[model samples]
Target chain A: MFITSIGYYIPDGRITNSDITEILVEDNKEHFSKEDIEFLTYSCTRKFEFLGIETRSCCSEENGDHFASMAEKAARKAIDQAGIPPEEIDCLIFSGVTNPFREPSFAIMLAHRLGIKTGDFFDINDTCNGFMKSIDVAGLYLKSEKYRHILVATCESPYDLKNTLKLDIHIENTDQIDNRLSGLIVGTGAAAMILSSDGGKGRITHYGEQRTSNDWDASMLTLPGTAVPGAKYGDTITGFWSDGRLISSSLIREMPEFILRKLSEWGLDAQSIDLFIHHQLGNNVTFALMDKLNADHQKAPVNTFKQFGNMATVNIPVNLAIADEQGLIKKGDSILLLSSSCGLSYALLHIVW
Target chain B: MTFDEFKLMVSDGLGIDDTLLNRDLSFRDDLGIDSLSVINFLVKIEHKFKFKFDVEHIWAMKNLGEIYDTFTEALNNK
Candidate 1:
């Protein structure tokens, strides 16, 4: 059984395109063309205010406690939906680009929050591919006769890094900070999924991964987080910085071949997928990938970039839960989950709902 | 340019209430000017004065007074 239950949360503040356009115009005389501004507004969901976000929320102003809150929200919702008590959960996984602290795995805090006393807990650091990998891991765990129920949760919040980065670096006519900061639009959200041994609403039929470290050039788009030097807590480091043009060029070159290989592994054609749920990278990247795959836009549900920014690892599950809420995915429909993370890791999962 | 006009432009550009801004207030601490807000402020100053800011000049700027001096120097140089 796969994804017996799924839940997601988006902060309440709504930042409309008009608000951004107005702010930009007043801030700078070089105004965005109305069409371009509208494209940005319609293409990505952004937060203009912090209304619904609590002080303890994952994306909140405070630090360290946000991840626990996100995990609790998603865990409680999924457990309730699955009709299982917390004690019955056998395994728990936390996946995301951002964690609240360095030690005490976010999964441990989540297990504590959910009161899942009888589960093995761990975390995966795959960023955008996190949810897909966590799903695959949980599936593998459930295959064991010793495990019955597994819960996987992913939470991402990149906004705090915005203030730390020096905004002065200019790369290709755009500030490196702005280009890097634009990645922040991939909103802050958490998603939890419940997997069971008994067959239910959905099943993961196949999984595949392809690594292309030769294109490590794509990893240039990085932030000063745990992976980088001088990024320890309270150090006040630079935020995200990137050569957007360079990253875009490399992704275009690498992703088409990656997608084709994954599709081939599933022994399925692009037309066979009833719903294509891919990573929420950005508008341009998503369009480029779909164009290469010759995917039917109708079959692909891409709200990740447009509605929730990128949410890194939370992209897939958040998209899936939104689809479930919107009635986009029905029982017995074939859904394709694909993601490409930093470190040049690519993964694909085929789920039959 | 008159200080009043420069103050008005700064107020409009930074989205600060016009009444709260004056030539006496410091941009960084008083206005809480950030790098993004400063970049936007420079863009506004360039348009208002009809001059382009060299990337290096922007990097050198630390405060409103420095920006004002730089703008005047660029104008005089032009």
Candidate 2:
């Protein structure tokens, strides 16, 4: 699939590590000692410092930027960039990691809101890798000579998930720090990409996927808390399930093999890879993967994780924008995307920019 | 919990092999255990022994013996 246009929506609300330190101080001042407060700040900030995430953006309830609204805003940008009305959109796919509603698919709601009455509208629930995977699927339809303009959108709201009444039960102390710190590291993001077979500036040509479920419950984006027990949301998990240590260790051990396998399949090597866009789980995971692959991610755009946290499905386009913003992307640059999720699903895509 | 048992959990959580389970194991230099790994490891230790040591005091620990001493003191006080 060739990329005709790319647009992204990052919430205006900014949450920094210091902001989290303030939040913890406000929420637990009465329960914690001065020493505890100092410890909490160090404990939280030290982790982010190590992970290389300084700030992130999330949906601002005060600003009225909910997940669906942000999705529409991003989709509009891509549609506008393509210089085509929503009616011309052959396929509208919503690849959201944090769904806003249950009954009606987020894609339908977004399509309706954008005044897109007719199209093959659906949702691809692939956790964080949905956007790129959806692009791979779109190529199949485009190759068969059916779809002309395939538009994929992603909207994630970790802030909204954290505020849910279900996940908001009181926590007695800092033992829950891992979950809470993970929450701090998460922010919402959305992006829209218009793809076509017209051979535009970008074309994704190769794809690979794998699942290693040995440590399935070891890391996740959501916690099975009091709000709902026994409930499951595989594609759209609430909050960020971060087994930072486990993910760091596992990705280091396995990602090199995955990268080499996919690259070899495409008759390429790590040196031939121009850019390896990765899931911004954190700085630690991304660097570990790159280091193991023996690839220099120095010029590769990765501001989304440090600046906007993990955007889930929107990570690829958003990170691409980060690359474009840095002038890292140019015509004819070889590109690749790598992603991993809690299901332990891993995907790699070879594209040209 | 015995010192050996506590050391074993740290080594396991960090994916450190048994040969590296010496008393002077440095978290950063030897194990490459970042802050998050240490937090997860400490949480696991808390679950096993049912005691929450002050993470602030223990995070700066440089060796396995100091880590064991920290937990030993926490259990003793309890």
Q: Highest DockQ: which candidate?
A: 2
Q: What count of clashes does model 2 give?
A: 3
Query: Of the candidates shown, which would achieve the greatest lDDT relative to the real structure?
Result: 2
lDDT tens digits by residue: candidate 2, A203-250: 877888888767665545544332533333244444444555566556
Compose the digit string of candidate 1's lDDT tens values, residues B33-55: 53434554565465456666665
Worst 10 residues of 1 chain A by lDDT: A48-57
lDDT of 2: 0.74
DockQ of 2: 0.13
List TM-score per model, in order: 0.66, 0.78
CAPRI accuracy category, model 2 = incorrect
TM-score between predicted and true chain B, model 2: 0.80
Q: Model 2, retained fraction of real contacts?
A: 0.14
Candidate 1 lDDT tens digits, A176-254: 2245434434467778888888855788888888776653433333444335543221233333443343444545556
Candidate 1 pairs with clashing backbones: A43-A306, A165-A239, A185-A309, A186-A309, A186-A310, A332-A353
